[model samples]
Target: MSLPAPLDQIAVRRAVEAALAEDLGRAGDITSAATIPGSAAARVVIAARQPGRLAGLQLAAAAFQALDPAISFEPEVEDGARLGPGDVIARIVGPARAVLSAERTALNFLGHLSGVATETARYADLIAHTRARICCTRKTTPGLRIFEKYAVRCGGGSNHRFGLDDAILIKDNHIAVAGGIEAALRGAKASAGHLVKIEIEVDTLDQLDRVIREGADVVLLDNMPPPILREAVMRIGGRMLAEASGNVSLDTVAAIAETGVDLISVGRITHSAATLDLGLDIALG
Candidate 1:
């Protein structure tokens, strides 16, 4: 499969700038400045300390380039490429002080984003046998939603709504406040433009029937077990798309996919993914 496009360069650069500012502060890497001569130059390799998928190579490169325009940042692999322990991701050669100052911020972006990609790949691989496509929810970091979503795509999963305005997804509370699913869907359909598709969440097969009757474009099946999900999919019968959500984990996702749902939305890939272990070491010359 073709990989998704990288994030906008301007946005990535802005994020890297902010991260570098946060790390540098007013004093600005006093340790490196005190030890390394301003004229000193070194070559370093950013290597993976554990096996995982790669993401955010551009962001890491941008971090170093922002710090020192003369630095040469060369990536060995693409963002979605799988990696093994001790694999060199990229090579950086520049003034030692600038490289050391940019090191932590670059690795932070790389490790965190690669972690999200790695987790997404795991979920995508588990459900590869079925028609269900792995998706990521909007539960992402505050300022990093776009970047995190990009990471999800890099790991072979699809993105959900990018924000509240992207689509109308009526959840349980919306239904509760709007009186019922029918009313909520009606309001959404009426308010949304002709191009906008309406999706509603339902907790049971009865609600599924109501959604089908009300002509929702998609139905989110919340917390349904595999058997119940199978029954729901059978009832749906391709009239509308079915999306499975809630408590999704690697152990349970395969069963959910086998039930024939069209989408499985998981929140943990971004919210709870463990950072991939990566380290940058100065190459001996």
Candidate 2:
């Protein structure tokens, strides 16, 4: 399926504005103002310094437009497209000061989000031979969860619960607080609406059995090794969706996918992915 359109423009603009405000501060771009003339116009190219999948192209453009509405920002490739080293992603032409001022903020969003997409793509590609799908957990940057999850989709991965309100996910802590797995699932079923699917986390095969008997919509197999995951999948017997999570990495995801789990959720895709290498270089006239 096609990925959803870029995030809400108004929200994007608000985020860009907040980033610019934090960056410019009360002094503004002193270096650019001191070194460049306000009327000077220049063209700059946004290029990837290393190879990776792309994301956040629209956010980068929004940063420039927020700074200078007249700035001409054009993207050569769309988000989710792969890039090689030295590939030009976009070109910007505008007042030299505006271009220089917006450079860091634009790249901050673009590179970081592209990193998320790239990491997600790596995980998705590693497990393509199986029926399992890669998904991202809620371990995302505090204010950027929506943007990061969108990047996951751009990379051919799926998103788990968007927020606590989106679904009923009974984790270990919830189980302990509510008494046990059966209690948590029963409470969730009693409290949640019929439309909301109930998913409970289980660490052992026994817990998995109880979850199945409790009639949950989905069961999360947390921290299960491939062998246990295989057994859990067999024991589940198509009764409910099975999700495997915890310690998921490029090195081990393929093995986990081979266990026949329905979904594999990785937290590091958004939480720990390194920013992709991208740079804004002034184009020679």
Candidate 3:
């Protein structure tokens, strides 16, 4: 899918800049500085070594462009495109030293986020024939939530709240702090502004029953097994939006979706996703 028009260039720039800053902090690329001629230009192809969905090509381009304004990127595949091994996703041509310097940082963002989108796409495809929607959780890299969540959308999955401030999520901890589930849910609904939605997490059937009785806007069923989840869906009976979360993985995601919950929020799709296999190869020009 095309990135949202009015793409957050500012946020994307900040992320690319921060990554460059981290890599070039103080010392700079000492090895490239020492070995590569400053004015030399090179052509490099970003090739996928494994099959997966692509995301963040623009960010990768931005990462290189920030380092070398004269650098040019020719994208052969857009974000959300399915790819096979050895696909040339993009070509970067610029000062050889700059290309080498920016390579890791560009691929760092590209590979990691693409991996998330790819994994999310797999889950999204698995549940596509069903009504369940794939979503992500608060378990995201700190400060990278916007990009990560954007990648989720690219994978055909929806996003949960960007953070705690965006909505009132009365989790188990909140319930503890507020004394009980009822108190927490009630307080959340009562104090939340009219525009805000109140969702609560329930770890047991009893908690789900309680939330259903009180009529929560959404109920997150945490760590419930398939049987329990199915039962919870029946118990809730559309009283609220039913969400199944906690330890969701590709192996069990289909089963979880079969339980008939409305949403599945998987943390591993973000926090623990492995970077997709990608590499920059210097092409003969």
Q: Which candidate has the top score in lDDT?
A: 1
Better model by lDDT: candidate 2 vs candidate 3? 2
Across residues 1-285, which tens digit of lDDT does each residue of candidate 1 receive? 568887899899889999999999999999999999999998999999999999999899999999899999999889999999999999999999999999999999999999999999999999999999999998999999998999999899999999999899999999999999888988998899988888899999999999998888889999999999999999999999999999999999999999999999999999999999999998887
Greater TM-score among 2 and 3 belongs to 2
- In order, the Cα lDDT scores of the candidates are 0.94, 0.93, 0.89
* TM-score of candidate 2 to 2 decimals: 0.97
Strongest candidate by TM-score? 1
* lDDT of each residue in 73-161, candidate 2, tens digit only: 99998899988999999999998899999999999999999999999999999998999999999999988988999999888899999
* Candidate 3 stretches greater than 4 Å from native: 1-7
* Candidate 1 TM-score to native: 0.98
- How many clashing residue pairs are found in candidate 1? 0
Which stretches of model 2 miss by more than 4 angstroms? none
Q: Rank the candidates by TM-score, best first.
A: 1, 2, 3
Q: Would you list the rank order by lDDT, best first?
A: 1, 2, 3
The TM-scores, one per candidate, come to 0.98, 0.97, 0.93
